[model samples]
Target: MTHSLEEHGTEREGPLSLQEIDEIIGTENPPLRNLRITYAYHQLAVALARLLDDRNATWCGFGTWASRTAGLFIRGELKPRPVGLPPVPPWVSRHLMTWAAPHVGSNVARGNLLVFQELGPLFHTMVTAYTEEDDAERALERVLQPLRPGLVTEGGQDLLIAAARSYHRAMPLPHSAARSQVILLANLQVALHEQIRLQEAIAASLAPPLRAPFTPAPLNVLATRFWGRLATSHLMDVYMPAVDFTTTRTLIPLRLGRDVGGAHGATTFCEHLTDLIDLELKALLYDFDRSPNSVLGSAAADWSLLAERMNYLTDFFRLWQQDPCLMQAPFTPRQAEDLRAGKMPSGPPL
Candidate 1:
């Protein structure tokens, strides 16, 4: 079922208060709560989208995809909706409510707060700093310091500094506009990281086998997450699209691509693609678990498909992690065009 804020006929000008959020969500019924949480994420995604500048193709592409994907979830369907798949099962809805909804609600609230409260003021300051052409470095350092605290090593600092210097250099934005976009982009990266964590948490919670004893994630996984977060946060033109909530079915033409010229390149590419696929698998497993015959046909066929997909994703993650590339660079226009044409640059086929 769909939930729309417009149904309440209330003005959508500012963030909804806690009481207002509750009223919109209405009952604690599992399915309804799940839908409301989905709606909340949708609102969060839209807020992020609005912050994106069209002059930056990478950021805009990611924002557009994220907003669209969240919109589809509100309808209980994935992008490029499967032809005859039934609605989400009842038990899955219950699981979503129990394991995912609360975190999603809180995260969305946090994201909104960050956008309006923290980032909003910083953005304004950045604009002013740029306009004066003084104290810009100090202003940027203030925004960057909090994102990765102790983890940003000397090398990482160099990357960040380089990123700041070259940020939006290819674009024609004025100084104030460029600086403001940088601030927004940095915070947006942090917010998106929260979204990815929520997705991983939901997947693990729903899939019993994945719920192993809590240990630190493998180094490669940790590395990928770190660099992915850092690149988007500091590099103006670098943006990783939020993970897809479901299968691609048919590959949509991607407008951005990268060249994997060496071992590091291949590792980075796989790390990125694997994260996307893992999230997609989560949605597939949700639909597959205890599904009715009408929804996905026989149990055997469904299990087979799920197993195959999981195995492929697992293999990629394993092999790529062996040679982890902890740094991610922004994509150039030519590299992005190569991706658009489905060229592998130099790595294994995606």
Candidate 2:
């Protein structure tokens, strides 16, 4: 029997809070009706990340929670797949296909290449210290000394900024469908760069000598898991959906909700997206389970928090389908001006 949300769990309480809604649509002309749902999934991602860090869980525990959370997410129910839809344009199909296909392989390979090209000597230094019976702490410090800030600088933060400039170039809105492709791609580029910053921060937080057993092995393991999680969760849950939403929205106008063909076409466009995302999640979980960090033990009580977060994210997806504007809210005038001027608003102090 197909499970309904009410039957299995509580009714959908969406991700965004009332205050956030106010921020999205200011007081002057409040949305005729408040959104029943909020952007809960993004919140969940942030919360889960905080838990991982604040708890300072072991590498194994971190790996396990990530894998399981992704697993439950993969197995969760999505909106019913649409049937009898007309075909999308070849360009749209091809673009969606690229988004669905696995990209982690090339990305991970590039990461390894960077390690060898830039960090090879650093690793060599550590190995030599081990062989020479030198102090592991001192060796690790020497290796990490030059790498932290260098990782942030050479690693594409600047490239991301340069790429955002392309987004500011005015494009014809009449061709919004096609233009959206460029816009979404540029945004994903920036998001990926942000992911790089996250990965770097994770690496930097490790005090080589202080953490002790100063070896590259555990660090390498952590790096692999970190990249895997980012690629799977971010690409699957956020990027692909954003692309699908844009493509479908551009091709099939939201006002055509009552038009059978238009609705079906939109549904078809999003139909396989979740499945594609789940495929990647499964692959990620499998890789994590096979890694040395996967331990044989009971899951922490915090696992429930992960489950709850996944539900929030899932519900957010449903809420977003009902109203895409929630996730793709229009940029305010000041925000647009800032973007055009190539000035990023500063994030809150860390």
TM-score of 1: 0.28
Model 1: residues with Cα > 4 Å off, grouped in runs: 1-54, 58-61, 75-135, 151-199, 202-350
Q: Per-residue lDDT tens digits of candidate 1, residues 1-350? A: 02122322212423323443444344333333333333333333333223333222222223323332332333233222112212434454345344433433343333333223332333333333344445656655654553332222221233233233333231234424333334333323333332333443322222222224565568545433333222212110211221121122222222111211222223232222223322323343344324211112211211112332222222222222222120111122343234333342322212
Question: What lDDT score is found at residue 247 in candidate 2?
Answer: 25
Model 2 C-alpha lDDT per residue in residues 1-350, reported as the tens digit of each score: 12222331112223323343334233121111111011222222223222212111111111222222222222231111122222434454334323423233233223222322332233233334433445644544553444433234565344243223323221222323233333333333333343354454323222121223565887866544443332222222221222233224222222111211212333222321222322323332333222111122212111112332222222222222222222221122343233233343232210
Q: In model 1, what is the error at residue 248, expressed in angstroms?
A: 23
TM-score of each: 0.28, 0.25
**Deviation in Å, model 1, residue 180 alpha carbon:** 18
> Candidate 1 local accuracy as lDDT?
0.30
| Candidate 2 lDDT for residue 264 | 34
Task: After superposing candidate 2 on the true structure, give the runs of residues whose Cα lies further than 4 Å from its correct spot.
Answer: 1-152, 155-157, 202-325, 328-350
TM-score of candidate 2 on Cα atoms, chains taken together: 0.25
Superposition error at 142 for model 2 (Å): 40
